[model samples]
Target: MIFRLSPKSRRNLSRIIPYGVIWLFLGWFILTLEFLATGNENQRPETEITLSFGVLVFASLAVFIAGLLMGVLEVFVFKNLFRSKGLGAKIALKMGIYLLFMLILNALTFPLAASLELGTTLTDEKVWEKFWRYLGSVTFWSTLISLSFHILLSLIYSGFSDHLGHGVLLNLFTGRYHRPLGESRIFMFLDMQSSTSLAEKLGHQRYFDFLSSYYNELSDAIVEHEGSVYQYIGDEIVITWETEKGLRNGQCVACFFAMRKQLESKARYFQEVYGVIPAFRAGLHCGQVTTGEIGALKKEIFFTGDVLNVTSRIQKLCKIYGKELITTQVLKDQLPQAMADQAQSLGDLELEGRAEKIELFSLA
Candidate 1:
């Protein structure tokens, strides 16, 4: 028998596994320190050593379990609970909620740890007595403090990972783009149709809210297609993908349609809330780009090449040609044959500021 997870599940698991390891190490570190302090190395009895070893094993297992539960709650349960709230409010709310959750977990684990030490059943009176006593002990407070500190660290990491895409953060930490490298990438320049008119109709604040909602809906499709958001400029979003990933099964093309379908599925919600269903246009092109990190105060992974310029020009032509989506022949040729066959040629069109005219295609 075999088991498999969807892309989203795999991403969630990647986040979850780290919490377990962090908590496990914290627990082991605390136990080992106490173990060393409580006894002499040459004079410890055999039974004491055995009991201490049992306590260490059981306590480590307990914290590891607690860590896994915390991961699930953080990833699936508490995520987005106060997504629209300010940072301070979100942090305060999560701290209160997680504090209570951690307390409950600690309470439950206490009796099991006591049972392992005493070699008694969890239901024994001694276990409950020990649990109550442990609650007030310095060790209990220390553990709580340690857990809080770790939680804060995790929150900071999550914030960074969210603001900068996870892939971008990993690359920055690993120094993968410290030196510039040229690579073939697919770029999609997507923009809302009639954004100026929509902004005028909705007003500034309302329009900002609308854009947030719009991007939130499209993000799922982009992630599913393994696209990284390059930038968000006003009502437009730029997405990029490695050539292999984008061309695989025509995922770059599929992502565009998927985003449209996602918005359409929420048509009633958008119409009821904002009095309009947003429409978008996109232009995609693939070619080599110089990729590297740049900046001192604010570092950013940037892609620089003529391909980006060409892609942007093609997207601008969407309004001129009155088309929903357009792509260059250079990219279309690399797509799956079935997808390529679906594209209707739009002839060689001259792009602004470029010497050569490039043949384009429109996906119906």
Candidate 2:
């Protein structure tokens, strides 16, 4: 079987790699400046530059390794603690912790590197003296300043990425959608059933809290199925996937059931929290769309296509058809054999605004 990274893992790697590259370049640039500032009187500039480049490779590699480790800690460990905190709190806490980690790493690594250069054991008196001397030097403080800048950048990027979906941040930087482009995509429009009544029953504030919990609970299944959350409009969430990704192992269809299962698993919690278990209906459709960047004040990647409207129409029909999940035949035909076999055809149906009739399926 071919190995593939889940969407979350790929997103984490995209976040982690930039830090290493930044450190590699920054380390080389700083070391070159140091050589130019404190070169031997007899040594030529070119010769000094060449020697500095040669020695800096090892140091740069060490810095890169440190960056990667720190990235892992920030992405996997610290991220969990950041969920409830505000931006200022997150930055301050990360800076303090990262500064301590960097100090500890530098303290141990400097001694090890020195011991290797002098060909002596770590317990040697010379290594201890050198390490203690370095603590008071300007270089040590400068290193801390560099690390502080790196941590701040990482935190800022992390916050932005979280706010604007991970893939969106990368695309914005790369300018992938600067020009309008046509592509095939699968979209799923999911909305809470009887949301108006539920809101009236629970009141505005309690309904908002219930909606938050509902979306949070279903997020795992969406991620696992490689779905990108496009938008959340009121009680409706629009999810999208690339054509190939959604078809793989019938993920588009499977995602619906997985989300249903997740909610069912959390039935008790929902019942206790809101005195009701939230239920949802979804419609899946796939087609071509023109994608491009839009908005001057607050930019976003916008998708313009009939498929979005058609998907919404299909979702609205779920109540009339009395089905939990409904999908277009165009999507059902492309699903895996096992998944496709479970589809119960609803025959040709007329959409609200379109003259053309469409074949729909309800997944069992």
Candidate 3:
């Protein structure tokens, strides 16, 4: 109850607020701008682009709550329902839904806004005329604003989708990788344990569905930890981050624990749906790699170096060590001192295909 949000509700509440703030600013700014540009100041000075303390506060809050509700419904309920429908239809549906939300929100909030002016938004004319005028203006603006915002935003997201990770889109456009750049990065290679058995048990289509559902659940943890998903190779996912960002606060290790916790929390759901709970073995490593754009038909950012190879080899050692999480000495040494107790040194070992041996640790 620290923020008056119950422990059970804290995570959901935290996710909603970030999206809520975006919606709040968009709604309030648009409404106020409309009033400033077209509202009749002489008729109602109090409500015409006037930012009274009570009106601004309550109006923004009402719209903000509506935004939060939209975010919750979109993420937890309606997101998956938006399937392979084409871009145009998706954009239309989103704008239409948001416009409906705005209409209802404005209906409730207008009264509060008028109260600040000691006046009503209604005209002293026939009831039907005032109603039609109010409804028309609200609906018109909501439609116009939502259509522009959602469609434009949809286009931007589509552009980003063509590239991997969040910032790759910008990197491509800016020619950031015209020359191969060497970067020190931390990588965590996660592979499903006994994936072959699980695939055979679930069958082809059902197996595909299982991975889809499992990855969807893990996505939240991935984003929360700021881990960039480098690629997905079948049941394996490679996550990478800059050395400083990944090692800072031991985020790279914490991400693994968070993902495990997330899946464990959903253990019952998986069992009921697929009759199996998925498990993963991860290997973490750090090294320098060259990054550059590759491929003509399909543009892509590729990372190449011995680091990837060594990381995969370490993941293979997980079966021998009987450990869920394994890390190279290089990565573990960079970790914060607080995490020292959690890592048990397995001593230096020769990883196959490489001449030299390196220290390895199993993270408990």
Q: Give the runs in model 1 whose Cα sits over 4 Å from its true position.
A: 25-57
lDDT tens digits, residues 313-349, model 1? 9999998888899999989898889899999998999
Kindly report which residue pairs in candidate 3 clash with one another.
none
Candidate 2 lDDT (Cα, whole model)?
0.84
Query: How many clashes does each candidate structure show, in the order listed?
Result: 0, 0, 0
Clashing pairs in 2: none
Candidate 1, lDDT over the whole model:
0.84
TM-score of each: 0.89, 0.89, 0.67
Assess the local accuracy of residue 323 in candidate 3 as a C-alpha lDDT between 0 and 100.
94
Candidate 3, residues 1-364, lDDT tens digits: the string is 4556532255456445645666677767776676688662334332232456666687678767866776676556656566667656765677677667656766655555554445453443333343445555644465456535733443344435433543576577579987899999889999988899999998999999999888888877776776778888999999988889898789899989999999999999999999999989999999999999999898778899999999999988998989999998788888998785678999989899999988899995
Give candidate 3's whole-model lDDT.
Answer: 0.74
Candidate models: Cα lDDT each = 0.84, 0.84, 0.74
